[model samples]
Target: MASPKRPIRIAGCSGAATDRRDAMRALAANCPNDPIDVIIGDWMSEANMTSRAASKTDNVGEAYEPTFLEALEPALPHIAKHGIKIAVNAGASDTELLHSVVTKMVASKGLKLKVAWISGDEVLPAVREAQKANASTFENIRTGEVLNSWKFEPIYAQAYLGGLGIASAFLRGADIVVCGRVSDASPVIGAAYWWHNWQRSNLDELANAFVAGHLIECSNYVCGGNFTGFKALETKGWENIGYPIAEISSSGGVVITKNKNSGGEVSVQTCSSQLLYEIQGPWYFNSDVTAILDELWFEQLSTDRVALRGVKSDLPPPTTKIGITAKGGYQAEMHWFLCGLDIDAKARMMETQIRLLLRPHAHRFTKLAFTKNGSAPDDPTNQNAATVDFRVFAQAPKEEDLMPQRFLRPCIDPIMQGYPGATPHLDWRQALPKPVYEYYVTLLPQADVQHKVHLASGETFAIPPPPQTKTYPAQQPCQAVTRGPADGGKWGRTVTGPLGWIVHARSGDKGSNCNVGFWVRHREEWDWLRTLLSVEKVQELLADEYAGKKIDRFELPNLHAVHFLLHDHLDRGVSCSSTYDFLGKNVAEFLRARHVQLPVRFLDRGRL
Candidate 1:
């Protein structure tokens, strides 16, 4: 039986640009502590993206958007030390571009290059492609109409490349990795399984890594910063914030924690709060499986760690595939703040005054406003001071020019007409207009993404070659009489992993989700592999394997594929959900679980 206990470990790097020296200082801070296996640094920000793009620091050549390189520069050297492999998506427009700089840096320092570049994810063009693929079923997520019918073009289009490509790169020997436009959660996932060279089809393994990714994806949240209601921390010594880490196992378990001696509480509530933050929906995707949420559960580990498990796969749900944000058109506003004895009266006065002021301006305003949030219980018993503010605007072709000075007439009259002393309030101003772009993330089919890891600048190095290739296990090609539906006649192929080669045969309709996929296994381990399938060797696969699941199986004559419903295997059943979070998976245990006993003798290839 699996132990209920979990590990206490957390990992992260301080890459925030409060100061350049802070990177090294953050690095030095980690130096004194016992080392954890992983270090996650979250250095990208959407706000930073806009700001960097404005400064041309992102250097996309169009003089816009922040480049991954600019942001990573301050943090790279500190990462390189301690020999911790770094994962970051600072590649900006060019995924390949950052590798050159890294390779050069390694060469300059006489350090081995452990760099992997993951790519094939720029989704801007995909909007059109997705629109075309979906038959215009996708509207800009907000707008009721189809996007293809419109003339508006986005400034940038990029997909949230999950961790796969980068993880694959780590297998290629990258000490420092860079990515572009990958969702923030992906790097942590990439780090967990990439170095180990995990099989892509290991759903549970993928689930664990994906969960780990989610925890550290948001920097301080997993640490003490976002975790509220915790007991006293040495706030005086809390100048540096703790970064999160995960001690993951191969079977898909995650233990979340932070640096030791770091002041913060890690508990179920804190962990739960982090899990639910900012998620617009129940699903989050990694490269291999789209994890289902309903299968996930979490429990606190030690003081600083929390464990998660029971993650499973699920079908992508039906929803609008396009993202839409508001267009910043011309508009109008009023700005005022009130303070007086009766906070309620002060607020009411401000409200009535603004309403009266906007009587005529309302027609001219595109979006007029007075929002009362934050303060609750308007007629408060506290009798505390209260202040109300108002901002209204007049629409125009351009937001900046909307209403100009001509709209100030009403604002200027507060001195003589309203309150005698309030007449001085006429010297107020309107709220500034700013563009509010819409944001959205869609579930594009896996087929839409074509991943590639192009290895270049291959100068031979003094670094010891990983292991003897002779002992490296080779995958045995399935001597199958057939492979179904793959346009290519290539029925059998050998893929490499940390242990050795796995020869996999292609098949179709593996599940009833109306989709097709492939499975692979080690060539020499056919006996073991055969036992895993519903094929001839296993007698008949059990429905209980699906945990009380059911589904129809079909074989497509055109494809020569035998497809069966996994039942609840990964959400083939209508009752299951999509979305899997990580809690515990020891890097070792997760991999070992897959190496089950079988009739055939297993072989070891090389040291990972």
Candidate 2:
């Protein structure tokens, strides 16, 4: 009989472009007991790509993430000494430029490391050609709006790539691999594929790694960074929160853990929080494979170690997600504080005054909103505590329309005549107009992308599309019962309090859509949760934010969770959104804070 092969350990350091810069060095140098075989990081996102496209259009900044270089510089010596391979998608738009810069850095250090870069994710030319042939080919995935109906001119387009290219570079004797806009989990998937030498037909194994990738892709997320139970980590302190590490066996079993002696934790609850983040539904799709998330489960194996099991797979879809960035317009804002009693009347009076002042130039503005941030407490202790902000936001197609004289003058014209205690913010620069970039997400044929890898050995080759593909419905059938909650008599007693008293949640954005997943810690609470939190219940709780928005709800019985996807809730997406919660990170917390009738049986255990 053959013996079981040893598992490969992969460490994740960065979650986004602006993540902690010293994480790479800390992971490389601080992990003594858990030596990693490879290091993978994700640096690209829809909002980031939009900003990069705008920068490139104006000829102002580099087209790639500069922080990647800063992160790699301090860890290069450790990486070379331990011979740990590295893969990252930090080369946002200009992979060739980043590749050349990294090569020079490696040589300048007198290091003989081989660096390779993968490109062809950028498809601006292909998108233009396709639009000329048939605009419907690039129709919006969310709204079904054809490309021809788009008001803004697209400046750049990039398709999400799979991990085969990264694996090919590793096979070609590359020590480091850099990529542009590959799917966030591609780096982890590629490392596992190269380490196991698995074939494309290994769908189950690939799916396991895919889920593992999703869990750790956000770095410290699975280690309690965004967890609702974060107060539990007070003993260790959050200053040095640990990054996640995935240990995958040859057969595709995965154990998620973090660096020893680091802050934060690796428990079933923490891992479950990351699993439910930013996901659309039960079927989690990537270019390489689709993971069926309904049946997946997590178990605590030991302290700071959780095992993932029961992951199933299906063939990937023939289409991949593509993001196009365009100049939306220009935006400006101003804030005024309303203090003490009658806050509602004060806000209404200010709104009426601002509208009348700008009534003549309303045609020039595309969007105008008067937003009230918070409500004052009935009996506040101090002046600061009694004040609430009333903000004015304006958007226009022309820069001059949003300038200080044109936009700010009308807003400030009603100061003396404004309600009493109305205090405008002292900062004049807050009213200056800034360029807005809109991010449009759509589907692109996989064959349209020329996915390729340039090896360090002076050889280059193309990566063909997946051998097998399957088509999935726009929405999967709900697997859990959605009937109303059972009679209150069975629960013995009930209490009214914050929903967070017995539930935990994680929420994020998918383009303009906001998805929030709520779960319970105990199995007994799952039944009450699934029945109590239905689509109508969610709408009732979030009436102000998503009352009229189209919402899709799904259940994950294995995780004791329910998810809600609110369509077009972000206004246009992060780069162009005018809402304070632009990225939708607070949607979960917002729902959690809403008062609800909670069963005392579940509350007896304790709050999250």
Best by lDDT: 2
Score residue 148 of candidate 2 by CA lDDT: 77
Give the Cα-based TM-score of candidate 1 against the true structure: 0.61
**Cα lDDT listed for each candidate:** 0.45, 0.87
372-399 in candidate 1: lDDT tens per residue?
A: 3223345555523344343433444355
Q: RMSD of each candidate?
A: 18.8, 2.0
Q: What is the TM-score of each candidate against the true structure?
A: 0.61, 0.97
What number of clashing residue pairs does each candidate have, in the order they appear? 45, 0
